[model samples]
Target chain A: MEIIKIVSLGIVATVIIVLLKEIRPEFPMFISLLTGFAIFTMILGELSYVIETLSTLARRVNIEFAYFSTILKIIGMAYIVEFGAQISRDAGQESIAMKIELGGKVLIMVLAIPILLALMELILKILS
Target chain B: MGVVSFINSWLRDIVVLFILISIAELIMPKGNLKKYIRLVIGLLIIFTIINPFAKLFRFDFSLDKVVFNYAKPETFNSWELEEIYHNQERQIEKIYLKKIVEDLQSLIENETEYELVDGDISILKDEDNYGQIDYLVLYIREKTRNNSQGRISIEKIEPIEINRNLEKDFTEYNNDESIKALISDKYGIEKNRINIKIYKKGIGEINE
Candidate 1:
C-alpha cells in the first residue's frame, strides 16, 4: 500500500541523513530538507484523493460548500504548518521553527473561530 | 458513489473524530464551565460528522456570511491585486504614448513649424507580418510669424484664420503624390476621409 511505500521512504531518508551527518555534515541538512519537501509533496498528492472523496461525500450529503471548504482549509493549514515546522527544526533552526508554529497557531485559531461560533449558534438554536 | 459504501467510509472518520473529542473531554477538569465547553465542542463535532448540513436548519445562519467569511477577503484582495496590475498597464501605456508623441513631434518638425495639439496613430496588422500605419489623426497649430514695421517679430495669431488651412493646405496635402500613393498602397483607407488639416497657432500655443 501507499502507507508502506511512504514509511519505507521515510526510513531510507533517515538512514541516509544519519550516514551523511557523520561524513559530510553540511549535506545532511540539505538531504533531509529535500526529503521532507518531497514527502510533503507526495502527501499533497494523497490529499487530492482525500479532498476529492470528501467533496463527493459533502455533495452526496448535500452539505454547503462553504463549510466543506473551511474544513478543508483548516485541515490543509494544520498539515502544511506541521510539515514546515518539522523541516525547520530538522534544519536546526529552533527559533524559526517556533515562529512558524506560532504563526500556524494564530492562523488556525483565526480560521477555526467562525466555525466554532456557527456551531455554538446552532446548539443555542436547538436549545431555544 | 454507492450510499452504503459512502456511509461506511465516512462513519470510520466520524468514529475516529468522536474518540478524539471524547478523550479531550475526559482530560478536562470537572467543572460547570468545562461541562458547557465540552458539551458545545462535542455537539459541534457530532453535528459535523452526522450531517454538517444540519447547521443549515437555522434560518438566521448563512453559511456564506457566518462560517465562511474568510473567503470574502480573498475576492477583495484579488480585486485590489487586479487594480494594481491595471494601474501598471495604464502607466506603461502612458509612457509608450509619450514616446510616440515625441517621435511624431520630431517628424512634423522636419517638414513644417506646426506644433501638434493632440493625435493618435493606429496600426493594422495581418497574420503573416507587421502591417502598415492604418490611419493618422493629427490636430496641429500652424506657426506663423509676420514682418511688422520692417521688423521680423511675432504676430498675434488668430484662431479664426487657421481653420481656412483645410481649403488651402488640404488640397495641397492630398495632392502630394508620394503620401497619396503611400496611403492608397499601404493603409487601404478611403481617399476623401483622409482630410489632413492644419490649424493656425491659437492662444496658449507654442510659437517658433
Candidate 2:
C-alpha cells in the first residue's frame, strides 16, 4: 500500500537524520527538508483528488464558486506556509519560523477580506 | 411547496458547506496560526448561512464580483491576462465617454438657454492621445417659455426650405461659438471639434 511505502520512507529518513546529526549537524536539516518535500510531493496527487471532490460537492450543492475558490486558495496557502514554517523550525530558526507564520496569517487575512466585505455589504443592505 | 423546497436546498447547502469546512480543518496545519484560520472559518460559516437570506431579500450586493476582484490569476496565461486587461480598459473608456457626455449635457442646460436633445462624442483611441475628445456633435433645441399662463399669440409657421439657412447661421453664430468656447475652456477640447446643430420648435428637419 502507499501508506506502507510512506511509512518505510519516513523510518529510513529518520534513521539517516539521527545518524547524520553527529557527523554533520547542518546536513541533517537539508535531509529533513528533503524528506518533508518528498512526502509532500508524493501526497500531492491525493490532495488534488480531495480538492476535486470538494469542488464537485460544492457545485452539486449550488454553493457559490467564488466562496469555494477562495477557500481552496486559503487551504493551499496554509499548506505551503505550514511546510515552510516547519522547515524553518527544523533548521532551528525559531524566529524565521515565527515570521513565516506571521506572513501566512497576513496572506490569509488578505484572502478573507473579500468574504468579510461581502458579509458586511449584505448586512448593511439588509439593515437599510 | 416552494417554501419546503427552498428550505430543503438551503439545508443541503449548509450541510455541504459544513462538510467542506470540516475537510479544510482536517487538512489545515496545526500551529499558532490555527486560531486565525478558525476565525476565518467562522466568518465563512456565517456568510454561507446569511447568503440565501440576502438573495431572498433581493439585496443588490454580489459576493462573486467582490471575490473575483480579489482572486489571483493562477491559471491564466500571458495572452489571457492581456485580453482581460484590454477588456477592462475598453469598459473604463466607455464609462468615461458616457460621463463626459452627461456632464456636457448638464453644463449646456444649466449654463445656456438651450435644451440638449441628443449628442454623440468620439474619443481618440491612439496610444498617445487616448481618451482625448476627437469630436462632439450636439443636437440642441432652443428652450421656449410656457405661453399658457400669458396670452397665447398665434404666429405663422416659417417655410422649412427658405428659412433653414438663415436660421442655421443665426444659431451657429450666436449659440455655437459661445457653447464651443465654454466646452473648450472646461474640457480642453478644440473648438473646431465641437459640432452643434440647432433645431427650431416646429421644424422637423435638422438645421446643421
Candidate 3:
C-alpha cells in the first residue's frame, strides 16, 4: 500500500514536471526536488525500523558497538550526501554536485581514520 | 570443551561482522563512494580475522588502546611510574636550564661588550641545595661592529700558527670578572661557580 502511494505520487509529480518544462523550465527542477523529498521522508520511517533491527541484532551478537555505530554513521552520511548531490545535479549544477560528493568523501574519511589507525597499529604489533 | 566454545564464539563474531557489512552495503547509496565504503569494510573484516590470531600470539592488540589512549588513563607499575616521573622531571629541569641560559646570554650581551656564544649550567640535585645553580660555564667573544653587516665572504684562508703565549691573552680579557660579578649579583649564584671563557675566534675574525 505504501509502495502504491509512492508510485502514484511519482507518476503525478512526473506529469506536472513534464507540463511545466516548456512554460517554466526552472519550475520542473523544484517539482522534482519536492517529489524527491516526499519520497525520502516516506522511506525514512521504514529505514529507521531496519536500522533499529540491525542494532538489536548487533547487540545480540555482542559485536563491538563502536564499529556498528561507525558503519551506521557512514551509511547515513552516504545517504544524505547522495540526496544533496542528486538535488544539485537536478538543478543542473554539476560542479556543486561534485563538491558535495567530495565533502562527503572527506567526512567519511575522517570517521574512518580511527579504525584505519587501529588496523595499522595492530599490523605493527604483529610485525614487531 | 573450551576450544569448542572459543571457535564457536569466533565463528559467530565473524559471521555477525559479515552480515553487518552486507547490510551496510545493501543500504549504502550507489555511486563513486561505494568502493571506498567497501574498502573500509574489507579492512574491518581483515582486522576482525587477524585479531584472534594476534591474541593467540600474545601480542598486545587492542583497538581500544589505539583509539582511546587519550580518553583513558592506563595504570602503571611503580617502576614505570618512577620512570615517567623522572622523565618529566628531567624535561622540566632541561627547559628551566635552557631558559636560564637564554636569559643570562641576553643579560651578558646587553650589559657588556662580550657576546655569549654558548653556555651551560649544572643544578644542584642534592636534598639541601636542590635546584640551585652549582656550576655555570659561558663561552664568550668580543662583539664586533660587523654583526649588523649580513654575510661577509672570507677572501683567503689563514695558515695555522701555534701560539704558546696563551695566558697573556687569557688574562688580558679579564673583563670576564665584571661579567661574573654581574651574574652573581643578579642571579644570586656564587661568583666562584660562574666560569667565563674567551673564545679564540671572535666575530671580527670571522667577518674579516
Candidate 4:
C-alpha cells in the first residue's frame, strides 16, 4: 500500500538520521532533506489533481482569471518559501532561512498589489 | 484539497520543521538569539498556513460592486464592519460565559459540598449597548445517586443573584429557599424578584 511505503520511508529515514547524527553529525541534514524531497515527489500527482479540480470549479463559478491566477501565484510563493526556508534551517543556516522567508513575503505582497489597487479604485469610483 | 495531497505537503513540512526546531533547541548557546530564531520560524509557518486563504481575500472590484449597489457605499462599509465586530463580540461572549459557568459550577459545587454533574449559563446582553452582559441565568444539575426506584425527580427554577459576588458562599445546597434568601441578603434584591428552579435528580419531572 502507498501508506505502508510512506510509513516505511519515514521510519527508515528516522533511523538513518539518528545513526548518522552520532557518527557524522553533518550528514544527517542531507539525509533529512532527501527524505523530505522523496516524500514530496511521491505525492505530486495528488497535489496536481487537487489544483486541477479547483481550477475547473473556479472556472464554472465564473471567477475572474486574474484573481484566480494571483491566488495561485501566492500559494506557489508560500510553498516555495516554506520549502527553501526549511531546507536552509535544516542546514543550520538560520539567516539564510530568514532571507528566503523575506523574499517570499515581498513576492506575495507584489502579487497582491494589483488586486489591492483594483479594490481602492472601485472604492473611489463608488464615492464619486 | 485531497487528503493525500494535504498529508504529502504538510507532513514533510511538519517533520522537517520539527527536526529543525529540535536542533535549534539543542544547539542554541544564547537565550536571546534563541527567542528571535523562534519568532522568525513561527512567522514562516504562519505564512505557509495562510497561503490557501490568500485567495479568499482577493478582491475583485467588478464582482464586489453587486454588494455596493444594494446599499449606500458608506453604509455598506460600516454595515460589513459592524457585522464582523458583532460576530467577534458574540464569540468572545460565548467563550467568557462558558469560563464563568465552569468557575461558578466549581465554586458552587465546593461551597455546597455537592457534586455538580452538568450546568449551563445563559446571559442576556443589553439591547442598547454592544457586548454588555446584563443578566445571567444558571441551570445546574446535581450528581445524584442512581437509586432510580425510590428517588423522586423534581424540576425547580430559581433566580440566584445579580450583584452577588462569586467569591462568597451564597447557597450551600440546591434548595430554593436558601438560594432566594442568600440572593436577597447579598444583592439586597427582594425575595419576590429572585427566582430559582429546583430539579429532583432521578425522576427529571418539573415541580410546579
TM-score of each: 0.44, 0.62, 0.57, 0.39
CAPRI-style grade of the A/B interface in model 3:
incorrect
| TM-score ranking from best candidate downward | 2, 3, 1, 4
Sorted into a CAPRI-style docking class, model 4 comes out as incorrect
Could you tell me which 10 consecutive residues in candidate 4 chain B have the lowest summed lDDT? B199-208
DockQ of all candidate complexes = 0.07, 0.33, 0.21, 0.02
Predicted complex 4: DockQ:
0.02
Which candidate number maximizes DockQ?
2
| Alpha-carbon lDDT, every model | 0.57, 0.77, 0.78, 0.54
Q: What are the per-residue Cα lDDT tens digits for candidate 4 across A20-87?
A: 88899899888878888988788788667766765665454334444554454455556667777888
Docking class of 2: acceptable
Give me the candidate number with maximum TM-score. Answer: 2
Task: Evaluate fnat for each of the predicted models and list the values in order.
Answer: 0.14, 0.57, 0.48, 0.01
DockQ class, candidate 1: incorrect
Q: What is the C-alpha lDDT profile of model 2 across A6-119, one tens digit per residue?
A: 888899999999998999898888887888888888888998999899888888877777677767877788878888998899888999999998998888887787678777
TM-score of chain B of each: 0.36, 0.53, 0.52, 0.37
For candidate 1, what is the DockQ? 0.07
lDDT of 4 at B111: 57
Off by over 4 Å in 4: B1-208
